[model samples]
Target: MNIYAHFSSIIARHLAALVAAGELPAGLEGYGFTVEPPRDPSHGDLATNVAMVLAKPAGSNPRAIADKLAGLLRAEPDVTAVDVAGPGFINIRLRDDFIRARVPEILREGTDYGNSALGSGQKFNVEYVSANPTGPMHVGHCRGAVFGDALATLLVKAGYDVTREYYINDAGGQVDVLARSAFLRYREALGEDIGEIPQGFYPGDYLKDVGLALVAVFGRTIRAMDEAEWLPIVREFAIEAMMKMIRDDLLALGIKHDVFFSERSLHTDGRVQDALDALKAKGLIYTGVLEPPKGKTPEDWEPRPQTLFKATEFGDDVDRPVQKSDGSWTYFAGDMAYHYDKIQRGFSHMIDVFGADHGGYVKRMQAVVKALSGGEADLDVKIIQLVKLWKNGEPFKMSKRSGSFVTLRDVVDEVGKGVVRFIMLTRKNDAPLDFDFAKVTEQSRDNPVFYVQYAHARVMSVMRKAAEALPGVDLSDAALAGADLGRLIDGSEIALVKMLAYWPKLIESAAVAHEPHRVAFYLYDLASEFHGLWNKGNEDPSLRFLIDGDKDVTLARLALIRAVAVTVASGLAVLGVEPLDEMH
Candidate 1:
């Protein structure tokens, strides 16, 4: 059970009672407040802002409301004490027995302990790492891939029916360059001496495999066709090959998408025209000339009259064009159709994960979702910042396989997949991250990945020692939960249990915020607490997890540490990371 949510309900009940007793004004049910841990643990266990929230509405000072609320809260069976702090905040300390009861609940649930039902199984779509189908994924795409995957996992844990999607940008000019690059490789494969790769074309030797594959399929016959006939076939073939490479890279990091939506399919199926017609029916489509944007003009900017979408009606800064002067659909038009298709598929909530470079694309895309869905759907875009790679205090080398940038495989190969995934989430999505090759792999407390995993491994080590020290004892979680937990009177032990009890509430907050980095931060803090308690045991034998010839206290301590292990494992699972039983 989520203790914070539990207390929130209790507070709401007391407020309702105050209204019924005529002590406070009516219609105060909608007051916004928070029931969370106090900033200073010594103040109390949990703090609430309800009195401050209801002060103005109740026509009284905050301290007066707090006194009335505190009086009612003190009568609760589980509340040890309640006090008014500062102007009006209520601080509550829960009974030790009440907090200890969560231990069995956690043991019974194991990794499923913190799962929440906040989403109510709503259909949610998360589109991320939709890199172009040109070559292998680079290190630049690694952060978004990991962030999106972790976010999708977090949403699923929050009980949402989520779809992890990847949109293949196969219809853009970049794929045409990929096909031409492969064509050059094909010529070289057939004993034709192709000169240096032309400027503005992909010069990566990675396309050599695509070239050789084409030769294996059609042999010399593909060479007979002209550019027009061969370009389409080559483009299709190249796109497929590149997607396979991209999929393999994702698989190395244990990521797989439910849908690989193609931009080409939207255009080929006439969905692009259908979406524009739908907008026209709503009177949001028009033909007009757009003024040159402020600052520098983009190469594709034009001042001529063109088909446009009335984006300003839905909160975009300005109207955006849907069709260009040459009568071709703009990139924005294809994106609009894609979202229109998503809405038709019954996803009312959508999230897009983009790199920092696409920060400007957020508003326009959100406007498209709002306009197309008639405001029935909502879209959230997360922008991931850049990751700077360093090695031995110097910049890391690039990969020749991916033309000039570091491939995702290079990073994954140097550090294991778990290290790569865990380290990527150590920062907020909008903040810059520095990834050091030596630091991330080091086996020290300074490395968050090792520190958190070591905490779990340390608990497992204690369990192993308990097995040998106290032979023939029932040590399973089920058996330990039935132990006499009243012996857990130590303050440090109770504090650890309280941390475990906070897991469910933490999951809900992180999922709602669309921030998976919070889980990483929480794991580090949890590890520190566990390690600190372990050190205290070395100084005082009474605080040790296993006591000589006292099975009751030993069992209680085992139950406590086991819950810590379960909680750490649960959090790591949410971040798409694995918890190790023993560290090398």
Candidate 2:
């Protein structure tokens, strides 16, 4: 029931017939031809660029080709009229009954109406919200979490096998800092009078409970151990605690990953060395000196020969250092191992979502994957920009160092999971987002989440009212399955039905672009149409849903409203937002 696709197929068959009859050249390409809603509805129901695209290849004037195609299209039963406009563009107006009849199909399909097969079983791995396992997730991680989760859902709907992943940075210096910080808390739990946290240690009170738990579990046993022996024990405990906190925060925001890859696992299983050996076999790894970093290299920086990868051969600024002068692997070395691990696991398409601060790291990482896989694997890095927090039009003050930074839990607590999810995706992933606590909670059109939810609620309200008015009218599929939708003849009613027809196309396009914000935008437009039609009923009594003395007309209109609700609910579900049945 994709009306555009259906009509496009008809037009394509007719064009093929013309080509067969020698009216157009044989072996001409028509795959790029598309049937879409006309920019101006008055022009026609749908328009195609086929004639224009084929004119040059057929060695004929575009108007002549358009004229022939128009006549061929006009002969179809579903097409009411066809006209050539704007340099051989064919605009088509379908029979009114054909447009109105789709309402029942929408109601029958429900939320699955817009599901697509565009992905066709491709395997895709989307890794996002891989924030370091050092502390709780904050507002910045919220945007990437929601975007990646919605993207996974969209890809799944489009028939792709998507695996949501989170990469944990539990093996870095940062985790060591976390270990030392937790050890301080452990001592505090053991009744030591530790003063203000040292300059280089974590000072958050969140770890106080971790300390208490450690004391309860180990008592004074860990207190007598040497630093070398106790550091590993404390590191494991700190990482587990921090990861648990992060998982709980994500759960609060309705996000969960299928895989949680640990950086430390690469070292523990000899995978890092194996990955380097694999790349070295391909001549991508070599021992060489990296040029001094440009533009203000630190005064203490010294040029030294070290183990470097031939990143320049694969398109990077310079050969990247894989091992430092101290004979220790750099962060990039472990990252290469991680990607190689992903490729070895048989994922051809991989995506990593990083914060905007990681923009400079993208090309180097892409270069590494390219060199390692010989271009067999593709890696896309999506950088989410910082979120500017606002409350009552003023910037919300919170310091990262003070450890009072607003965690993801704080956001979910303030506005529940649904608002947090929807508001996070209302802006493009790469663009800066201004999230106002006060404005988002306002119940008005200015708040997009509220507006969309209100539209769904309004449709539900109408359904309830209609059911109460017309008892046993059969909203069931068996009764409405053969609905007489021709009675829905109002312009506004047709417009609403036409909007519902675009859902499948919208879902496929949004998935193709990897832009979930488009879903939010489409829902906003659908809600606007629903709201506009609702307001139109105020002026024309006949346009109202519950019409007196007109049972068939009421059923037809009720069917259309149900279709809108179904589509809205489907889109919101993809975005992880609950469709509200009643507005508060």
C-alpha RMSD for every candidate: 1.6, 2.3
Instruction: List residue ranges in candidate 2 displaced over 4 A.
Output: 23-31, 51-68, 297-301, 313-315, 397-402
TM-score of each: 0.97, 0.94
Residue-wise C-alpha lDDT for candidate 2, range 1-584, written one tens digit per residue = 87877877787888889988988888775446878999999998999998878887888899999999899888888889899998899999988888887787888888888888878899999999998887888888998999999989988887889999999998889999998899999999999999899998877778898899889888989999998998999999999998999999899888889999999999899888887898789887777766666675677567787888888887788888888888888999899999999989888888888898999889889998898788999888888998988999899865453285777777788788999899988999999999899989999999999999999999889889988999877776446657789888778888888888988888888887888888899999999999999999888888998898898888887788888888999999899999999988
Model 1 spans > 4 angstroms off? 296-302
**Per-model CA lDDT versus the true structure:** 0.93, 0.87
For model 2 the TM-score comes to 0.94
Candidate 2 Cα deviation (angstroms), residue 149? 0.5
